[model samples]
Target: MTITPLSDATWLAVAGPGRPASTTIGGWTLVGEVFNRHDPAVRQIPDDDPASYEKKMLARFWGRFIGVRLDGKGRLAALLRDPSGALDCLWWAQGPVTLVASQVPEWLARSAGAGWRINPARVEAALHDPYSTSGDLLIDGPAAVLPGAMVTLNDGIVSELWRPDWLARSAPALSDDEAAERLRDALDQVVAGVLKSGGVLAAEVSGGLDSSIVAATLARTEPDRVRLWLNAWGPDATADERPWVDLLAAHIGITATCQPRATGRLTLEMLTHLTLGIRPGLAAMDALHDADWARRFVAAGIDTVITGKGGDSMFIQPADAGVFVDFHRQRGWRAFLSRANIDLARWNERSVWTLIGAARRPRYTPAAIDDPNPLLRPRIHPEIARHPWLQGIDDLGPAKRRQILGLVQGCGLHGASFQTEVATVFHPLLAQPVTEVCLALPTPQLTLGRRDRALARRAFSDRLPDAITTRRSKGEMTAFYGHLIADGLDVLRPWLLDGRLAAMGLIDRDRGDVALTRESLAWRGGYVDIMTTAAIESWVRAWERRLPGG
Candidate 1:
């Protein structure tokens, strides 16, 4: 990637291996991977019509990109990421030098002056939910552009271009059958497009509904070019997911290779080499993938690996509480009560009146609870917590609301940091066309009769088996994460209690040491929190190593 200065007031950061081209539409200079989906070498951008170009860019349903356009004379610039943010773009301003790049570390390297400082409040917010970006740039003034957002920089001020009202306008306009047919067609288009130049395509088959759908679709469509891979564990391990995996492979007439899960003593010393380049604030669990798998892909000449990630996000999986609301709004109180009672019974929630009250309200109000932080919680500024990119958007109708929430929460999206190291991970479910259709699906078609992902079940019923499609209970990785921490807790000790977070006054060392005991780690959500906290610690250490003095 090279940072090309377009003009006195503007610059473009180009990354990846594509032959990027630039075109001047009106007064704006547009650059980055803007190409034809059918022929990447061919530019599909409209040169004569600026308005048409804007429409096409925003409405693009597929392909990878990090496009930017700048009007230097006007002192304005715009940045856009792919729909799922496959290519990440980060920008930070230090004095008069403003830097943006696909890699955050690269941008920081070019930063001049006093250098960047950690935002303790941002660190606290990241600990709250590590999976979500939470709008923290982790620096004093640097900011990250959110997925699907179009950010404009005007006179040093940056603002995002996402209208919630615009998304609500595209609500489901077709019947159940029509929606199913369209979704299937869109899935086919996305999957087929991804496999068009297929060379040793492999997919992660977890035996779950979503992966099954993707694996089965691939098997049916491009059986000759694809293989299945499963991350296997001992039968005694709660993370074991091979039975269903074998079942699906047998049904599809394909062979699957099971890769052993990564195990053994976990320690900061072992991860020290990896910490320096680790993406700040990402959960440590994200880095827990088996290295052997990537090597296997290389050995087998696999270039791309398909996954059923973002399936729930795109399809708006069955909502436990909100389904009642959709039921009441669509049907009368009678139908709402009937479905609510059944769902409540399934969840062991026994208040029909309470359910009705929940349904009456647009969104459920959670009871005030104690903070999840085990140590002294850092004081965070209200502005930091309420960053526009981190804030919840309102006014989007329920279906579209679910989809956008999933995207913002970052479902099915993988980090681009490892794009070149491992086999390219493709998520057809998150394809713009598929995601748009699924978001437009009527709420009833999604959660009616207490069936989650009903649209998907109906759409790919023939391709998947009855057992796989009908299974309702999803697997959890609590045991898996618990064991990961248990194996490495000793090595992660110093960082957990006395790391950068502690030095920043974001956590109390004494209290954190007491709170992070093995006994406490066994509690529900405890392992996950510990893992995330450790990740933050590792990131802080990484930053310390990269910057001046410890």
Candidate 2:
């Protein structure tokens, strides 16, 4: 059985390549792969012997705890219950076995030991073992221990495989300083690895802490071979990335060209939407359009793009909400209920939605948490929660850390970014050495909230200029000339107003108006979102406008 939850959900349960994993177990449409979940019920077993009033009690318990049911043929379907016998979690329904997934100490009381296979490779093709189909990104979970290997999946496609060895933690782990040095060395190895395999020793330096570290390490190793490029809306007159790019260039003392070009919201007139179904209207479209920016590096003897894609998500922790939660937990419930200097309630009301709402004209409503929210636990998705490592996301306190783990773990919408420019994009920070140890280690060693990426700053203290290393605040490289939104609005006027964006089946037409307005007013949205849309539209139109069978 294929174990991985297919990235393209429609392909699995919908059409592509799989058997319908369903039947009327009790009367309800026992959706085999129910609602983006990939688990199955094997069977159900009973617990107690017949006592005096056992039938009535068992019937009520089964109905409530397990959601038990009967088909016209009297086939049974019910949820699994905990030891005290409560409807705690889903059941792996098989004959005579009542398997339960409880958050407490014990689980799987009487059922056949539920088998879980988690495939962790971001893409299954990378796993190299065609026999293993779990499709999870990390083998099982971050803490899941597995052996690295070279396995042949199919003829002609040999892939490298590495699994986490959590047991290694039993031995002495590298000290914070040692860990930093080891990480730098590992990064250096990756740079050589990429180049050795006829790939590129390149990085997309966003001047943020993440990419800056990569860029600095790479430059120190091979400054002469290094080529740097930045996405600029216009020339230096607009201050388009000239300041930071110039700083980096001078630091490396290399002829780093910022390659300032004008691939605004509507880059090419005829071409509109981009590949991977992104609208040239969003920030991803900008990257998709700028992906051609990669052609220059390709010409400059570079073949791959090493990037800090998951760096921010994996490396940094969000502002502390734990202060409030902890303060409440220790001091009193009243203190916790009150908003600390920082709280989720305030943030949701302040930053993202507030600004966007003002310009766009809609009020924001927050999602209400009903049951013991997934924010409190990982078992919300029974199948996904199987790997003990995902439990880390749960154990993490405060909502910010939880969100960060979610972003790092669940890359469900990565393709929406519309990054087709570079051949290969590597998030080396997600490299096993980096994720398992470097990130999960002591936070004070790396960063102290808004203090700084202390670990990176200290390691490269001598190499990087103080301007770069000491930088606490981050910026959007395109923020300088993002004012071009008004200009792009003029250019894309026909496409947006005429409902062409919708007709193309790319963007949600309902949202097209608001998105167009955001672009028209030069009201800065988000760098990621705006660029995504711009890139998608340009690619789609370029392909469509390609000389017919040229």
Candidate 3:
């Protein structure tokens, strides 16, 4: 990808293929790839109020874009980022000169003159929380144009323009069946938009609700244009998902190419291909496998790779506490207690009072933090530790609000991090329209009968098999994470002992190694902490090699 500086106030980077449509409307110049809508006629560009023009545009538009309108004097009037934040927008400002680009490295490279060095604090934060920056590239203090907002750089003054809270609107009053039908239609539109890109579409089907729904919908709707790829973890692994994979594939009537689970230690050779700056935990490792699969798609003439990534966050069921509150508020104490007992039983809770206490807490909080690695907590920069990781949004329902905000602020960042150069990965479930409908769903519709993701299961139950639609437990990739540390002491000694992260005082080598050795079999957050720290070490090594004198 080439990052070309369009001007002091603007820059451009093209991903995948096709040129970004650029037009001069009125006295303003707008550049972006408009999907699901025609290029905004210059006449559509509001003459007196540029901010209103953005609102009007977003009210009617859908697609991944980074757009900026310039005044006749070549001054930036407004900058727009996609609502779903699918495309990354990295920008750094120095004095009056503000530089922006789609890729992080490009932004960093240009901002080097602005005294932008790798921040040890941010780097360590990335290791501790991969979803740090809410999926925006925030390692070096550059601001990302996150979803549902616009930035204006006029007269060297930068201001943010926020669009209305469209996603959090109440669902049209409809019965469960009607809601499901509506959801199915929205998903169809999102999938159809992805297919419009043309060429063969290959979906990742792990037999999970999200992937199964995507793969099944595509195969059922456009069987000729879609193919399925299942990452079967082979026979030795207990509780493999291939049975469900096979069941879904058989039901869809399309043969799925099962790619055996990836096995191998993280090799030095693989680290050499790592992208610069801190990436999400095990991102490079995940990319290694994705790239391999992408090659097969390329050979098969498939250009678009769709996955079920954002479905979990997007089609979120209301939080248990929120559910309890809703029941208590809408019905009576008896009803709330009835539902509360069911939840307690399902969760195997120790006490109903304890669940009740937790349910009473606020849904959104500045302190609703992640369980950071204990070892890493001491090393984290004090300021970073104290800073609020997630911002609170007021317009959304507690459950849907936090879920979508988490998606945009946290998991959404991972969307682009897992992409391969050969194939374009599309998360149809994460599309703005799709997610909007998901957030608008009535609470009961989403979690009816105390079932999680109930709306999704009901929406496409007809297209999916019972095994997939009814399964409660989510698929795990412990096998994959375990493989990273499968070699134990020898595999990570060199990197962990004296690598950049340890050298920066961000991690204690002896302690990390001991933790890894002590719990090699435990594929949980401890494993993630070790893997993420190691991935950061690998990234540091790659960046060091690219220095003027290594």
lDDT of each: 0.61, 0.38, 0.60
What TM-score against the true fold does each predicted structure earn? 0.82, 0.48, 0.81
Steric clash pairs (candidate 1): none
lDDT per residue (tens digit) for residues 1-550 in model 1: 6565677677665454544456554444444323233322114335674344554554643455555665536344676665555556676565565566655553354334145666666666766655345344666645666655656655443444333334445564677788888888877877787777445787888778888888888888878878546545533445676777788888998888876565565756545534333255341243546455666677878778887888886676645555555556656677554854576436535466765777677665333223476764656544345444334545433544555656655522445324235566777787666766766665556654455787788889988878888886776676766667766767766766767777777777776777666776765336645666776777777665555443
Write the residue-wise lDDT of candidate 2 on 178-214 in tens digits. Answer: 8667556656654544444443445565556666667
- Strongest candidate by TM-score: 1
Distance (Å) between predicted and true CA of 523, model 2? 5.8
Identify the leading candidate in terms of lDDT.
1
Candidate 2 residue 139 Cα shift, in angstroms, is 25
Looking at model 3, the pairs that clash are 134-409, 134-410, 135-413
Clashes of 3: 3
The number of clashing residue pairs in each candidate reads 0, 47, 3
- The parts of candidate 2 lying over 4 Å away from their true place are 1-175, 199-206, 224-253, 264-273, 276-284, 287-292, 317-392, 398-422, 442-445, 478-482, 490-515, 518-550
lDDT of 1: 0.61
